[model samples]
Target chain A: MSLNESLDALRAKMTSEAAGAYEEVLQRLDPRLLAENALKPGDVMPNFELPNAEGKMVSSLELLSHGTLVVTFYRGSWCPYCMLTLQALDLILAPVPGQQASLVALSPETGGRARFVKDKYNLRFELLADVDNAVASMFGVLVRLPPLYRQRLLSQGIESETLHGRKGWFIPVPSTFVVARNGTVAHAEIHVDYTRRTELDTLPLVLRALRQYS
Target chain B: MDLPQIGYFIVLSRVLNFTHAARECKITQPALSRAIKRLEWELGGDLLLRERSLTQLTEFGRAMLPLLEQVQAAADVARDEARQLQTQERAPLRLGLSPWLAFPLIGTVLREVIASVRSTEFSVSVEAEPVMRERMLRGDLDVLVGLRADTLPERFNQWQLFSTGAAVFLPRDHLLAADELIHGSRLAESVLLGASEPEALPERILSQIVRRLGRRPSTPHRASNWETSLQLVRSGLGLGLGLSCWPTPPELVARGLADRLPDYEVVVETIAGRPQSRAVSTFVKLARASAWMNPANVP
Candidate 1:
């Protein structure tokens, strides 16, 4: 088996383990189970336009114009998992010359909050502000925080006002997709909760598969 | 009372000259005189012995200086405490992660944090490279996992967890896997899978490979996350460079190139002046335990 096959097998085993543990933790999760809407290997990506940290506009077309496009959606700059994951991705940008893809990260954070990722992690990829998570909602990845957790965040002064100068605090589930030049998603991963994240080591394997498919 | 004016009075009383005291205070001579007069009026007593040719502090002025200094010192302490309270009110726990580690680690870490911290609340964030350092400097993030530099910010404290080695990620069938050591020139012709720059991978490995080849990589591709990169590698798009800290899946081969690369020691660092939260402390402890932290190497 190739490296990708072994990883897939390992992933399957982990998912099964998580499923068993999930039986117990399911009670703590939101009643509305997360919708299964992940992009498939050959699914066409929808067009999206969002602002960069400077509030300058960027679109899916422009981003996809590169031979390959690596797009990641983050909860915000404040998430440690997002930080680590992005930093890891920053470390592995070469080797996928097949698509000549541009890497873009989108989040609800704008201006300073958006810039915080780059300022803090020293990441060079384009960090975009998804504004209201409108695009994320369209992708069906937006989820509401449990009411108690929402209040807890507010007590710590991370309310919407502090993050975006608004009263409503909304966050999206973190997701990532590898889109080929033709706009088809070659690989995608989405996590519902705040804690778990996509492993950084698997990116190269996915890119290699993408190159094969392309 | 206008304490600064009183302070001026104390300084003038010592110097015994409005001209000299004004220069020291960065004010005009007339301003110094007015300040001293105001201090005397506020105290309802003459605190300075002033004559045309000679000036001195009266006994009352001399006695008052030490008392005023005490009051000022107390005020400074109060101001500092108030600032601390404000910061505590806005306390945030910024945590950094590489894409590979985020998902599996986040849930457990936060669950550990919530169990330990009942009073203090926190906001967790993820960030990439230089931003983690910059945010720590700007007082935005309280702690992070980043490259360990010889010199950290003066006000920050760092804990070294462990050093992760970089490896060449290849498919099981790759010809190079048969060789004990992967060479730089061999990596050039093969499609290379990498992140944007060398934030986590050792700089030496990347530079050596490029330097030995004498140019940029021939067919380089970027992956936003490690999982994707691994997927790309498995599909035979190219090879990968990654940390040995985590186990590679059974199919892929992760081997250290000859003359291994020394990239960074994973560390948990905090802003110098910020007070540590219970959650932050607990998370650090667990991270140390999980990564087999060594105390002997603490910098």
Candidate 2:
């Protein structure tokens, strides 16, 4: 099943009131602003360096130097939706040793946490720590999770330490981008609703198109 | 409810300038114009008259502005009420603890409070004294745990927690680290650190040193906050002054002042006559009864 199908199944389990509340939260997220500020298909991708799972610093410039780069910014291991999306990406984008394509995931969590997620999921892609959402903000995808949404997250079993960040629950808008070798954004997908994600099936087409730059 | 669009439109209605209106809404001009257009489409008809260098609300737009704002206000109030209802069930307890109390000391009080209180969910706000006081007064915070105030406003009911003195923190290998007690004059000998504006307590602490020693700090550099100041001190930048109650980090040892700085009284304050939630009242009671907060333990 696709990532959205899995998300739909998860949503189906929610009660009517819960579903309604979820809808309201997404509506208030201001998709219009996200569209205005987010990186476009032709926009140049900025270079950044973030700590990887093993505490090694990873640079976007170095990643692109190899080939096309597929980067996804997720919430973290705590979010079930993010978990499904990440697992989907891992299965669909399995790295081919010296192919002209690379995959990496970044989150605002610490490198120690990225290490745990990598180990538990056995992910092929390198997971990097974008401390304080520095990389996400560069892509114009960082959003301060509403206080009420944060409280709801806390009320449901998740510990405060996991959600309440120094800047108070900032998470990326669940964005994925394919950058060409020339550093221009070849393709971009930013999900404001979060329950929806960049369809994993589309990556093959986007990558095939990136063959020119590769 | 289309609150976002209508909210944007309402702001646009007032400013009568797309650029200025967009600036007010914190969105781009094109985005604001698009929102106004979408809202007009939804409500049926042109709501705004946009021509070369001219912006004005049409008759329908002017008529809808008040109604739209009313609807928005009603929506906001409903949302807030619902949030409060949801919150009342098992809301987050906002605890503002001043640096005047040590970490372990606050930890002990919180552990006991959670055990006794029905709700275990809580958030801690560590800020300068004036910010915390204003937050408490504005009802943004449930309770403020500490700040040595000689007198609080009549609107607040305060419980005296304890009296603790301030101390100087130094890197273990610093020249003055061997001194039995750091005198005020000795503190003036080195560079000092303090937080910049809006963090009033650190400024007050730094100022107090100048008043007693009768000289400004040799050369003071400002840090963003207490933690940053401590980090600078740990890096051996200079001496740092802070509440004696803050837990001393392993890298730095705290020393008392030979010149007695007046003891600071940490107090627990909440709005007077306001009905206290179980969490708030329980926290206050537990804090009051905590043995570590007892006044007799500190000199």
Alpha-carbon local distance difference test for all models: 0.59, 0.69
> Tens digits of per-residue lDDT for model 1 on A1-214?
4323443454455445444433433333432333344455677776665545433445677667667888888877555556766776677774344546678887765324555566567787888766445455545454444445555556656665345322344556677777888988777776654445535457777777777776
- Taking the tens digit of each residue's C-alpha lDDT, what string does model 2 give over A84-135? 8888889888887766888999876641567677777789899886654556
Pairs that collide in candidate 2 are none
Number of the top lDDT candidate: 2
| Segments of candidate 2 deviating more than 4 angstroms | A30-32, A157-164, B1-299
Worst 10 residues of 1 chain B by lDDT: B290-299
Q: Which candidate is the best by TM-score?
A: 2
Error of 2 at B281 (Å): 42
In model 1, how many backbone clashes occur?
Answer: 80
